[model samples]
Target chain A: EAGVAQSPRYKIIEKRQSVAFWCNPISGHATLYWYQQILGQGPKLLIQFQNNGVVDDSQLPKDRFSAERLKGVDSTLKIQPAKLEDSAVYLCASSSIKDSYGYTFGSGTRLTVV
Target chain B: SQQGEEDPQALSIQEGENATMNCSYKTSINNLQWYRQNSGRGLVHLILIRSNEREKHSGRLRVTLDTSKKSSSLLITASRAADTASYFCATAALSEKLVFGKGTKLTVNP
Candidate 1:
C-alpha cells in the first residue's frame, strides 16, 4: 500500500503572503490530520478530519489558517497573511480510526516565511 | 499548552548501547505512542501502549507506560547507527486528539 503523500516538500514565502499545502492520505484511511512543527518543537495539531467532516480544529488559528478535506481522501491547508511565526514544518497524517491505532505521516511541507 | 514534555532534549551514544527517552504528560490519556523521524522526513510510528497496558515491545524497541505517574519511556536496546533520529511521544486523550512532546534527538555513533 502507498503511504500518505504531501506536495511541495519545501516552500519559501514572504511575510503577509499566502501559502497552501496539500496532502493525500493513505488509501482506505478514514481520518486525516494537519500539524505544525516548529524548529526544536513537537508537532501541534492544527486540524483533524474524519470522512470529509471536521472532527476537531480547536487549536487552529481561525483568523489566518483554514483546511478542508474535499472528498475525504485529499486535504489542503492554507494560511493567509503568513507571519514569521508561521514558518514551520506542516505535517499531514492519516489513520484508520479514532482508536488507539497510530498514524502514518507524510513527508511534510517545510514552510519558511521571511 | 503542550500536553507532553520529554526529558533530556538530546542524547548521544555509541552503537550497541541502549538509549532511553522519557516523556511526561499533564492529563489522562487513552494511549501513548512513540514515533521516529529521520532528518527531514515524516514521522514513523514505532509503538503504541494503551492506558490499560503497562508495557509493549516491538523488536528492539520497548515502551513502558505508568499511568499513575503520567509518564512513559521508550528504550531502544542494542541501538544501531541507523537509529539516529528524533523520537517523539504522543498522547492520545479521550477527546481523540494526539498531543506530542518536543521529542529527543538521539545520535548513535558507529
Candidate 2:
C-alpha cells in the first residue's frame, strides 16, 4: 500500500512571506488531516477533512493559516504572512472511512522561517 | 490542546535493557495509540489499544491501557540502538481528532 505523500520536504522563508505545502493521501481514504509539530512538542491538529468537506478546523489560525481538501483526494495547507513561530514541521495523515485506527502519515514538510 | 501527559520527558538506556514510558490523559477515550518519530520526522504507528483492551503486544513493543485511571504505558523489551526516537501517546474519543502528548525522548545507547 502506498503511504501518504507530502511535497517539499524542507522549506525556508523570511517572516511575513507566504508558503504552501501539498499533501496526497492514500487512495480510498476518506479522512485527511494536517498537523503542526514544533520542536520538542507533540503534533497539533490544525485541520481535518472528511471527503471534500472540512470536519474540524477550530485550531487553525484563520488569520494566516488556511487548508483545503478539494475533490476529496489531495489537500494543501497554506500559511500567509508567516511568523517566526510558524517554523515547524507540517504533517499530513490519512485513514480509511470510519477508521479511528491505522493512520498513515507523510514524511512532513519542515518549514524554517528566518 | 493536549489530552495526555508523558512521563520522563527524556530517557536513556543501554541496548538489551528495557524502556518504559507512561502517559496520563485528562478525558474519556475510546482508544489509545502509540507512535514513534525519528529525527523529528514523520511518525510511525506502534500499537493501538482500544478502551476494552487491557494490553497488547507487537514484536518488542507492549502497551497497556487503564481506562479507569485514564493512563497508559508503553514498554520496549530487549531494546536496541535502533529504538532511539521520540515516543508519543495519542488518545481519541468519539471524534476523529486524536489528542497527543508531548512525547518522550528515548535514547538506547549501543
Candidate 3:
C-alpha cells in the first residue's frame, strides 16, 4: 500500500505571504488530519476531517489557517498572511474509520517564512 | 495548549544501552501513543497503550501506562544508532483530540 503524499517538500516565503500545502491520504482512509510541528517540538493538531466533515479545528488559527477535505479524499491547508512563527513542518496523516488504529503520516512540507 | 509534557527533554546513550523516557498529562485520556520522528521525516507510530491497559511491547520498545498518575513511560532496550530520533507521547483525550508532548530527543551513539 502507498503512504500518504504531500506536495512541495519545502517552501520558502516572506512574512504576510499566502501559502498552501496539499495532501493525498491513503486510499480508503476515512480520517484526515493536518498538524504543525515546530523545530524541537511535537506536532500540534490544526484540523481533522472525517469524511469531508470537520471533526475538530479548535487549535487552528482561524484568522489565517484554513483547511478542507473535499469528497473525503485529498485535503489542502492554507495559511494566509504567514508570520515568521509559522515556519514549521506541515504534516498530513490518515487513519481508518476505527479510531483505535494509529495514524500514518506523510513526509510533510517544511515552510520557511522570512 | 499542550496537554502532555515529557521529562529529560534530551537523552544520549551508546548502542546496546537502554533508554527510557517519561511523559505526564493533565487530564483523563482514552489512550496514549508513542511515535518516533527521524530528522527531516514525519512521525512513525511506535506503540499504543489504552487507558485500561498497563503495558505493551513491540520488539525493542516497551510502554507502560499509569492512569493513577496520569503518566506513561517508553523504554527502548538494546538501543541502536538507527533509533536516534525524537520520541513523542500523545494522549487521546475524551474530547477526541490527540494532544502531544514536547518530545524527547534521543541520540544513540554507535
The lowest-lDDT stretch of 10 consecutive residues in candidate 2 chain B is B91-100
- Each prediction's TM-score versus the true structure: 0.97, 0.98, 0.97
lDDT of 3 at A59: 91
Candidate 2: the clashing residue pairs are none
The superposed Cα distance between candidate 2 and the true structure at residue B32, in angstroms, equals: 0.4
lDDT of 1 by residue, A1-114 (tens): 899999989999999999999999989888899999998889999999988999999999999999999988899999998999999999999987643568999999999999
Candidate 1 chain B weakest ten by summed lDDT: B93-102
Q: Using TM-score as the measure, name the better of candidate 1 and candidate 2.
A: 2
Alpha carbon lDDT of residue B81, candidate 3? 98
lDDT of 2: 0.93
Per-candidate DockQ values are: 0.86, 0.81, 0.76
Cα-based lDDT at residue A44, candidate 1: 96
In angstroms, give how far residue B106 of model 3 lies from its true place. Answer: 0.5
How does model 3 score on DockQ? 0.76
- Fnat of every candidate, listed in order: 0.85, 0.68, 0.71
Task: Report the poorest 10 consecutive residues by lDDT, candidate 1 chain A.
Answer: A94-103
TM-score (2 decimals) of chain A in model 2: 0.96
> How well is each residue in B1-110 modelled by candidate 2, as lDDT tens digits?
99889998999999999999999999988889999999957999888899999999999999999999889999999999999999999998877688889999999999
